[model samples]
Target: MVHIQHKVKAFIKLGSFLKEYCEYSKKPIDLVGINGSNLAQFHEKVTLATHKNGWFSQENINFSLLQWSELLTENNLDEWLGNYNLAANNYKTVAIIMAGNIPLVGFHDFLSVILTGNSALIKQSSNDDVLLPFLADYLIQSDPSFKDNILFTEGKLENYDAVIATGSNNTARYFEHYLGKKPNIIRKNRNSIAVLTGNESTDELHALGEDIFQYYGLGCRSVSKIFVPVGYNFDTFFKAIYSYHPIIHRNKYANNYDYNKAVYLMSEFKIFDNEFLILKEDEGYASPIATLFYEFYSDKTALLEKLKQDEEKLQCVVSDWPEMKTVAFGSTQKPSLADYADGLDTVDFLLKT
Candidate 1:
């Protein structure tokens, strides 16, 4: 634990250093690209939402960055930082297959493999190639020792003690069949869900929209579908979420909304929403492209049963409804350091291997 403390301090200090450069001096750090493409993408989303979706408020960027700083300081660094003495000395390499839906989605995996004292063999997602290598370069500057451990390439998987892979549902079977023989954690496409009772406050509904709209709704953590009581007032819900109007206005996003809306309209399907776009559903998960949303329910009992049946497809559930353990609403995009993938801590995984 003493070693962990020192490493944590180092990480906090490094993060503070980077923050100072970005927030105050405007000094650009070539690596990490936190202020480069990553921040650019986020800014682009906000701009698009303002112009297209009619949602203009910058709700949580500062708060999220503060939380990120906190995560750097408070999370156990030995668990994530290279602790050569603690490693079993058996595993020499850690192969990571990363996801790219949200901005910097693969960062945690990159951190896990490198910080746990193993060589990283990364298969960068085409969507996320810019950020991870940028981070690798940043970390290398922070500690020259890290240079040897981080690697980027494209090819077949090599001999490694453990592996972590994330993919869509159709590809999960292949990941399991091919990589399961080795010690691995293979992730499949899973959607975040929401459970709504008729009794939620307007504030709660507004916050839920943040989860759905943040990151332009591209994250696995984004609430793709909603579950609400049958008699809930559509007017009340729409009014509560109108603050997110900027999201529907961005060029790319507006195009998506327009395209998806046209498709649904041409099909002669009934739609819901004030003016933006929301779609009602009969059954099944996932929303359509045009600023779409869904809701369904017979009763709590049936809802739980249905959710149980599709447990494997679920990434996380955000709900104010009864019976949820870790449901979070507005803060969906802001995952803390402790939220482990597959409920497995990377440090513990590395130690075991």
Candidate 2:
């Protein structure tokens, strides 16, 4: 088995390559010791990814790359892995069934599997099939040992010891039925919510817009619903998010906006519209694209209690409320390595398996 430090070093090198690639536009002449041909190949792959999935816009893909580049630092990796013992007498093959909702959505699971000295058998969602294999190639180039550790399959997954599968509530049931016999993490649907007090500054609300609109609101961490005080004026909130108006120009997003708006209007549901976004009083957590669901709360205690009761359905809570755990405004997508999805510790799970 490859040593844990060797695996960490390979990831750090990959991070360095990603950092340079994200900044490549600023320094066109300097390859910065990165393989020039490989850099070109990665750019081509990014273009191919966009062509394959309209939702994977160039800007969103770059944002994901920059985030990973920043996160894969030695300090961050060390701090995240320090809590667990990584030594193993034998390595296991872990199967990862990925989701394609956003770019690199399954990367954290893949990373956890590799870092724990296990082989990864990845079955990628067809919507996001281009990028991760290219990244795995980069890791293998950095250290040839990774070539044996990573495998991608288009057929049925077999010969794996454990599984980590992510999907919608329906698909999750399917996954549990087929893969549940193994040690597994079957993740289902989860959405994020924001709590807004009337006193939020324009800047805070503006930041919240990032949490809502980034990744075109496709990520599980994206805030799909908001809780506000009764009779809260929304003028400030509207103005703060007005900067994201250009998002409506994207054809796919515009199509969703127009379609959902028509359906809402035909159904005689009262909705607040600004031509680009529709705000409806919805108790549901998962809002359709280009729409935001909202509810009014009268008592903070009761709201917290309700939220606590529904914790399993939530991926994040964007708020500054001191009584409960909260993610800062606009920072839901920028989770740390330790921020496990569904509040389940992946590394710990893998270590035990």
Candidate 3:
């Protein structure tokens, strides 16, 4: 069995390499030291990732690298793992069905499986196929024991003890039909939202733009909608997010904005537009790119109650309100190791089942 300390050191080395590689301030570093060439060979994968998926912008990929780099540090890793005993006697293969909406979105599950000393049978999204394979290779280089532990499958999963699957609400039905009998954690579509009491500062509202605009508003953690109190003025909100208006110039985003705007215009629906983003009075949670759905609340009590009741359909709530489980305005994307998807603890599941 691979010792837990060995696995920890292997990931720590990987974190070091990522820290140096993601130093966007300086010139791009060559694959250096022991595992450098292996990583250097995968630079082409990054290019292919952005090329194959128009929504996977270069900035967003870098953002993912930076976030992972910060998370894999010795301090951070130890803190996260300290919560569990990490028993490794019973070895099992944990199959992962990852989503492709954002870069490295499935990595947390991969990490959980590996850190628990279980083999990971990964099935990556075609939209995000390149990066994780190379990352798996890096993990092996850091500790050769993992070479036998990590495997990627193009075909249907077989011989796995448990599953972690993420997909749209549509695909989830198929997964439920196929993998329901197995010990599994199946995730469906969930959107994040924010609450605005209208007492927000200019800077606070401005920082909120990061939550809405990051990753082109693609990730589950992205704030796709907001709940505002009655008599709320959107002029301040619109002005604060104007800094991110440059995102409209991107071709895919521009196409979406143009197409969605034309549809809304022809339908005679009421909307507030600033040529870059549209604000619609929508009760729905998920908003398309270049549009934000908002609903007006008569009071906060009913809104919080509604949010609590529908928590399964929501990923997170971005808010400055001190009353509830709120992430600060700009922090929805930067979840810690403990922030398990669908609020299910992967380590605990893998250990018990």
Candidate 4:
């Protein structure tokens, strides 16, 4: 078995390589630990990924890389892993069914499985197939022992000890029917929200825009809805998010915006439009792209209670509300390693399995 320190060292090297790659535009390429040929191949794959999925923009891919680069430090990994007992008598094969909503969405699962000395059988979404495999190759190069630990397959999944699947509410049912008997972590549809108290600074609201528009609002952590106080003015919110106007120029996002806006208009539902984003008074959490759903709350205490009752539907709550747990403005997309999806401890689950 590969020792845990070896695994940690390999990931730290991967983090250094990613830092250099993401900042290559600003500095000369220093291929000391990284293979130059592999870097070129990875660059080609980034281009291919963009061609295959319009939503996987180069900027977003780089952002994801940068985030992981910062996160994979030895201190961060040690701190996160120290919380649990990682020693295992016999490592199991953990199957990971990844989602393609945003770049590297399933990487945390892969990392957890590998770090715990378990083999990972990854079934990637076609939308995000190219990047993780390339990264896995890098990991193998950093530590050849990983060669036997990572596997990606398109065929039927068999002989896996545990499963971690991510999908929509519909696919989640299918996953349960098929993989529920195994030790599994099956995730369904969940959305994030922001609570506005009508006293936020201009900077705070602008940062909130980052929480909304990053990844084009496709990520589960992206804030899709907001809770505003009764009689709240929306003009400030619009002006704060105006900096994200360039997002509409992306063809796919623009198409979604135009289509949804037309449907609302034809149906004669009242909406607040700013030529780029629409604000609708919706009670639901999942808002369509280019639109933000909102609701008015009369009392903070009652709103907190309602949110508590619907916690299962929420992945994040962006707010400064002292009465509840909340994520800081603009930091939803940059989650720490310990921020498990659906608030379930993946590493703990894998270790126990």
Candidate 5:
């Protein structure tokens, strides 16, 4: 435990140094033990992929960078570090089975583990292979001491003090079967929701659109369903989100939009459409395409009852209504460092021996 405390302090110092480098250079420091040319290529990939409209939308790109900077800054990381009490904790390694729902979704977990004096044995998601290593390169360059603590592997992970696994509901069964004996944080598929009272302004509704469609509706944090008044006007809501039309025009996104549209039509599903968006009433929260999913309700009490029935499957809920604290909107597209999950701090999960 004493050793872990020393190591975490060192890591905080390292975080501080790397943050200074990023702010001063305005270039991500991916140059370390690896080749300089390769680092350049990786940075180029990040820039091109983010800037190009074909791969990601403008709002998505902007928000992605916003989160990257948030995680890289000294002020944010320091606040995150202060939130933990690592004095009497010790751990050798923390195995992370990361999810690939959005770009760099695993980054927060990685930072938490490393900063809490635990070595990370990462089993990278096929969907998110690039981000972790890119971050590791910068950390390794900022301070050589970090190289020993981070290991990327496809090999078996056992005898670790703790594990953090993120997957779908079906995969949670497998994670439990294999890792049931160890202290673990196993995350299942959970969708976010939004609650709208009739009092929302136009700006508030437009901002909510960013939360719903920023990652093309692929992220688990993305709002998959909106609870609205039964008599809500589809025209007013769609108009607020019409600015995102260019995003739907991308080939990959358009393909999803077209395919889902076809399925809705073929099934003779009832849908309301204007020039900007589609309004469909569905039972499930998750949607198959890049569309805003919704469920209209006549009464708030009934909606609350329905939400309670599926509380275990929900990750976060957003609302203009004040009763739900787990809910957020608009400016909260990038969550702060304090947002814990499964009722546990990730850094604490890592540091517990």
Candidate 6:
């Protein structure tokens, strides 16, 4: 078995390659090496990915790589693993079914499986596919020992001892029927939301705009809805979010906005139509692209209680309230490695299994 230290070093080297990749992807620079292999393949993968999936924009892909570059460091890795004894008495082949909403959304699970000495069978999402394979390639290049441990599949998953699948609520039903017997972690539809106190600073609301618009509200961590006090003025909020007005220029986003806005008008649904974003009074957690659902909360205590009760449906709660388990504004999508999806720890689960 490959020692854990070797695996960590390989990932750390991959991180260095990623930083250089992001830099060169923006403006061509001198190529560097990972284990003596120049990362020209990194640029090739990014081009193919953006063409294959239009939603996987270069900026978004680079953002994911930048975050991973920061995360796959020695100190961060040590601190994240300090709480667990990673000795694997029994190793299992864990199948990872990834989601493509955001770039490299499934890398954390892939990292967990390998770091715990378990073999990984990854089925990449067709939407955001190319980045992870090249990453896995870098791992193999950094350490030849990883060749047998990391695998990517395009067919039906087979011969896996455990599973980790992420998808919509409808797809989760199918996952439950098929993989329920295995030691598994199945995730379903969950969205992040923001709570407003009406006294928030301009900087805080500006940060909240990033939460609402980053990745075009495609990731589960993006804030789709907001809770505000009764009779709260949205003019202030709108002024703060004016910086992101360029989102309206994107053809795909513009189409959604125009289509949804026309539908609301035809149906006589009263909505606040900002040129870039629409505000509608809705009770649901999930909001469509270019639209934000707002719910009026009269009491903070009651709202907190309800949020606690309905926690399973939430990926994150962005708020200025320091007392709650709420993340700060603009930070729902910037979670640390320990911030697991569905509030379940993947590494611990893999180690125990």
Model 1 misplaced regions, further than 4 Å: 1-10, 21-67, 74-89
TM-score of each: 0.81, 0.97, 0.96, 0.97, 0.85, 0.96
For model 5, the local distance difference test gives 0.70
RMSD from true fold, candidate 2: 1.6
Select the stronger candidate by lDDT from 3 and 5.
3
Per-residue accuracy of model 5 over 101-120 as CA lDDT, tens digit each: 66667777777787777788
Q: What's the CA error at residue 297 for candidate 6, in Å? A: 0.9
> What TM-score does model 2 achieve against the real structure?
0.97
Clashes (N, CA, C under 3 Å) per candidate: 15, 0, 0, 0, 1, 0
lDDT by residue for model 4 (1-353), tens? 34878999999999987887777634435464436666667778888999999999988899899999999999999999989888753589999999999998999999999999899999999999999999999999888999999999988899899999999999999999999999999999999999999999999999999999999999999999999999998999999889999998999999999999999999999999998899999999999999999999998889999999999999999999888889999999999999999999999999888
Model 1 Cα lDDT, one tens digit per residue, 1-353: 34334434545665664354335323333446544554444344434433432222333333333445556654455343444455454446888887766545676776666555567888877655553464466556556666677777778888676888888887789988888888888887777778887777899889988778776776677788888888877777788888988766666667878787777779887877555656657465666544545766767988888888888767678876566555666777777666765565766677677
Clashing pairs in 3: none
Residue 146 in candidate 5 has what lDDT? 77
- Model 5 C-alpha RMSD vs. true structure (Å) is 4.2
> How many backbone collisions does model 3 have?
0
lDDT of 4 at 316: 95
Residue 202 in model 1: shift from native, Å?
Answer: 1.6
Can you tell me which runs of candidate 2 are displaced by over 4 Å? 25-34, 88-90
Q: List the residue pairs that clash in candidate 5.
A: 317-327
Q: Which runs of model 3 end up more than 4 angstroms from their true locations?
A: 24-26, 29-39
Better of 2 and 6 by lDDT: 2
Worst 10 residues of 2 by lDDT: 25-34
Higher-scoring candidate on lDDT, 1 or 6: 6
- Candidate 5: Cα lDDT at 245: 80
Model 6 backbone overlap count: 0
